[model samples]
Structure formats: structure tokens, C-alpha cells
Target: MTDVPAPPTPVTALLRAPRHRVSPRARLMWQVAALVEGAVAIGVLLLVDLAVDQVDLPWWGVVAAVAAVLAWVAVVPQWRYAVHRWEVTETAVHTQSGWWAQEQRIAPLSRIQTVDRAEGAVARVFGLATVTVTTASAAGALEIDGLDRARAQDLVAELTLKADAVEGDAT
Candidate 1:
């Protein structure tokens, strides 16, 4: 008698669309700066309040700082979200982003010539980095920045391997 074959395991919904998000600290520094500015503004109000012995004009500085801080707070989440999403599929690496409008960019493995990484002051603080992929097509060099460093390196290595495989297949 022939034995029955085992059923295939189902893929996890989470892994179906694998995506890497940017480090929270990638945009936290700017938000923190906004908060500090707001605090300084409060201090300025207190000083002005003591100097004039009148409740006038000091409120305006506080109001302006609060408004600015509020605006930054409101806007940061979307920017951070946009910056975070980076994904690679079997065929291409996809970058989806934008705030007011959405943008999607795709880079095929065969076209990629080099993959590099970068780090800056804020990025270092967040332990975040950048990955730049170069292509022969010359579309002004697409760059994916503000990623966690180890993740970026792993992506680079995988893409490099895929590129080599594709090149070998072509020849």
C-alpha cells in the first residue's frame, strides 16, 4: 500500500509581506528637539512674567512654541512611518514612502551594481544607518536611509548574492 503525503504547512500572515521598519530614534531626535524648544519657551514665559509684573506678551511666546511643537508632534508619525518601510521580495527591493502623497520605488536584483551603508550623528544615537544601492541605469542613485545597521548589512549581503546569481544565469 502507498503512504499518503503530508499536507503543506500554511505560511504565516506576518511573513507574507516581510517589511523592515526604521528605528524609532530615527525621527525621535527631531521630536525631542521640538519638546526642548517648548520647554525653553516655558522658561522664557516665566522670566518675562517676573520682569514686567504684568500678564502681557509672555503668553504669545508660549503659545507660539506650543503651536510649533504641536505641529511637529502631529506630523512626525507619518514621516517616521514612511521612512521605516523597506522590503525585498524574490524579484525586487521595494521602498514605499511619502507624507502628503505616497511613493513606491522598485529595484530589480539584476540592475543593482553595488550596495553601501552610511551613518550620521542622529543615526548613530538611534543605532540606525543607511543603505545605498547603485545601478547602471543612472536614475540618480536610489538611497534607503535610516535603517538599523545590522539589518541593512544583511539586506545588502542577500541582494548581492541574488545579483550574482542573476548575472551568472544571464551568461
Candidate 2:
């Protein structure tokens, strides 16, 4: 007697993690982004604390703010890089993203309405780009960020071709 394993059901397939990780440089990019954001937020707090004499913020408050921002800069980027991943197949594109809260999305080729690639000023400095896939679903678009500039462009073209070849507008 032989035992055969059951095939992967759609639900199970959706639960499975995607195969590819974002570019390793994404960690550096994320870290820089965190630092920039922390700087802006901390700068604002310093202004409020220093400029507004009417509101005397405790020294601990300022210390806590710095500690929080430093923690975010130290943790978020590495966590995000570890957690975020994406993949595209003949039938669908899958993605998982986030640091604190994770989100997973699957978009089929037949349902894809548009594919776009974006390069943020900061991301461009790192030679990275994001590819966005818009689908007919009401949930909204799926974004695969932290890809190499060339890779993102290639993904956009590949998705466009695959979506175009499919028959019927997946509504």
C-alpha cells in the first residue's frame, strides 16, 4: 500500500509564505528611513519642549522620546527586512509585509488592472524601487517594495505582459 499526500488547497496555498526576500540593501534603506523619521519627530519634540516655555516637559519625557526613537531605529528596519517578502508566478503575485503587524496579499494575473514602478527620492539614492500592482479587487493595490531599480522595472513589465495575456476582465 502506498500513501499519497493531499494537494495544497487554495486556503493553504494562501497561508504559505512567499518565496523571495527583498533586497539585502533594503535593510540599510529601512535603517536610514527610520533615522530620518526619528530625527524629524525628535526635532519637533525638542522644539515644543524648548520653544514653548508655557509647557515645561519633564526631562524624563525628552529622555523617553529619544529612547523610543532610538529603539525604533534599532529594531524596526531589521524586523521589517526580515518579515517582508514577495513573489510572482504565472498565475498570481503574492506579498507579505510589515514589522509590527503583517499583511499578506495575493493578486491573480487575470485580475491585475495595472502595474507601476515608483522610485522615491530616498529609495533612488539607494538604487531601489517599488512595484505596485493594481487589481480589480476592492482591497486595493499590492506593493512590492525594496527591490533593485532594474528588478522593479522588470517586474512591472513582466506583470503587465502576464496580465495582458489573460482572457476576460477579472471583476
Candidate 3:
């Protein structure tokens, strides 16, 4: 006889709902960062091309490198922005992110060791912040980025409180 797991409850259903999304400005920030990175990559490739030219190497190599970088810069940010999402429920913190390979993570409150909030210079300019949740799992910390500054702070505070309330082996 095969064993079947029990069906999801109302709470789980609510938690699984695709209702939560990152701040809209996150897309802009991600795109802008991508552009900056792309620019740097292009600059380096151009320098490499210059050196290669001096050696009479194939110009196609440099063109290919720049094309690859441009494609990555153009596609990845939009894909990530469309997919990234996070939700904090009473039981756990759920996050979904990534571009080509999607990833979903759930960190239960009981296993949470700490909650932290951070803001980079670019994020500050956009009034954005990232919340990092440390857990006992071997996977290390989970970061929920691109949240509005105030929302990130609230999430950090709430997660801290929840983690405090739970009793577990929070290694």
C-alpha cells in the first residue's frame, strides 16, 4: 500500500497564494544595476579587444563577448523582476526568485536564528532595502531583496519577534 500525504489546509493555501510581489521600483533598480554592470563588462571587453587587435587576433572573439554580455544584461533583470516574490506568514518566510532556474525557499519561524535589514547605496537612492533571515539549515541565510525601506524594516522586526517566540534548535 502506498501512503499519501495529507492535503493542504486553509492556512497553507493562503500562504501559497501568488498575491505578494516585490516593490515595483525594484524592476527599475535591477535594470539600472544591470546596465551599469553591462557597461563595465563592455568596457573590459573593449580593452581586451584593443589588446587582441595589437596581436592581430580574431575580432569576432571580442564581438561575441560583448554580445553575450549585452544579452545577459538585457534579459536577466526583467526575468528576475517578473519572478521575484516573497511572503511572511505566521509559520514561515517564503521566497521565490531567480531567472532561468527558479528557486523557492521556506524558512520556518522555529528555525530562524536572526533577522537583519540592509540597504546599499543604490537601494537607498530608491528607498529600498533587503531583509536577510538566518536559519539553522545548512543552506545558510535567505535574502528577500527589493522591498520598500519601511516594509523591509517591518518585516525584520516581525520576523525577529516571531523567531523569539518560537522554541527550536536554532543553530
Candidate 4:
């Protein structure tokens, strides 16, 4: 009797094996950013409270508001750091990010139109960079943030080379 070959596994299964995590510095950066945002939010809330002096807010209302802001500033950055991950394979660039709502995206090398590296003022201070991969999809580009500056540059070069090597449309 002739032997039959095993069925090929789906690409999704292969892609799900594991993911690489971002640097610990990412958490620090996020915490700093979150603190800044929390401060702004608290300022706005306080201003609103002052403007509506006709109606006095309960003591618990003010306490809860402050507590919520503090909790967000203290917790969200760490949660985000734990969830954000990225991996570059021969076939695709996979990225997963989010805290409350998770998102995973895969961009095939063949679909890559451009690989860009960007640095914001805060990121520059931390020596971090974000790598953006533009593809043909309508959802826009995929971003891999919190990479070291050198690592981001290397990724850009590597993606560029891989995209160039692939000959067909990745759609």
C-alpha cells in the first residue's frame, strides 16, 4: 500500500507558537507617559469640579476620582508592557499590543511597501524607537514600538531586504 503524506498545518497554528517580548524599559517609558496623562486628566477633572461650584460634589466622588486616576497611572503601564509583543519571521512580522482590548497583526514580507523608523522626544530621551511597517492593507501600517534605537534600525534594514527579495504581491 502507498503511504499518504500528513496534512499541512495551517499558517495560523505555526504563527501561534510563541512571541518575543519588548524591553523592560518599555514599561518604564509607558509609566512615565501614563503619569503625565493622568496628571492632565486629574487637572481637567478638578477644573470641572471648580467650575460647577453650585453643586457640591460628595467627598467620595472626589476620592474615587483621585483613586481611579492614581490606579490607572500605577497599573496600566505594567499591564501594557506585559501584553505587548513582537516577532519577525521569515514570512511575516507579527505584533500584539493592547491592555483592555488586545490586537494581533501579521504583515507578510511580500506585502511590505515601506519600513520606517521614528523617534519622539520622549523616546529619544529613553533611546527607544518605533518601527512602522506599511503594507497594502486598508488598516494602515503596523507599528512595533519600544525597540532600542539600533535594533529598530536593524529591523528596518532587514524588513527592507526581505520585502525586496519577495517577488509577488502579499495580498
Q: Pick the candidate with the highest TM-score.
A: 2
Q: Sorted by TM-score, highest first, which candidate order results?
A: 2, 4, 3, 1
lDDT of 3 by residue, 2-31 (tens): 989888777656545334788888888887
What is the per-residue lDDT of model 4 for residues 1-171, given as tens digits with 9 covering 90 to 100? 999998999877765622788777887888788777877887787778789877667779778977887788789888988888898889889999889998889888999988999998878888999999999999899998898899999989999998999987766
Model 1 per-residue lDDT tens digits across residues 53-139: 666765677678678768876686547565547787787777755555755567777777788888866667777778887776545
Model 2 C-alpha lDDT per residue in residues 1-171, reported as the tens digit of each score: 899998867876547889999898888888888889988998898898788889788889888988998888888888999899999988999999988889999998999988999989889999999999998989899999899999998898899888999986967
Query: Residue 3 error for model 2, in Å?
Result: 8.3
- Residue 61 accuracy (lDDT) in model 2: 89
lDDT of each: 0.69, 0.89, 0.83, 0.85
**Best-performing candidate as measured by lDDT:** 2
Which lDDT value does model 1 have at 138?
48
Candidate 3 has an lDDT of: 0.83
Going through the candidates in order, what is the number of backbone clashes in each?
1, 0, 0, 0
TM-score between model 4 and native: 0.86
Model 3 error, position 94 (Å): 0.8
lDDT of 4 at 163: 90
- Model 3 pairs in collision: none
CA lDDT, candidate 4, residue 113:
89
Task: Count clashing pairs, candidate 4.
Answer: 0
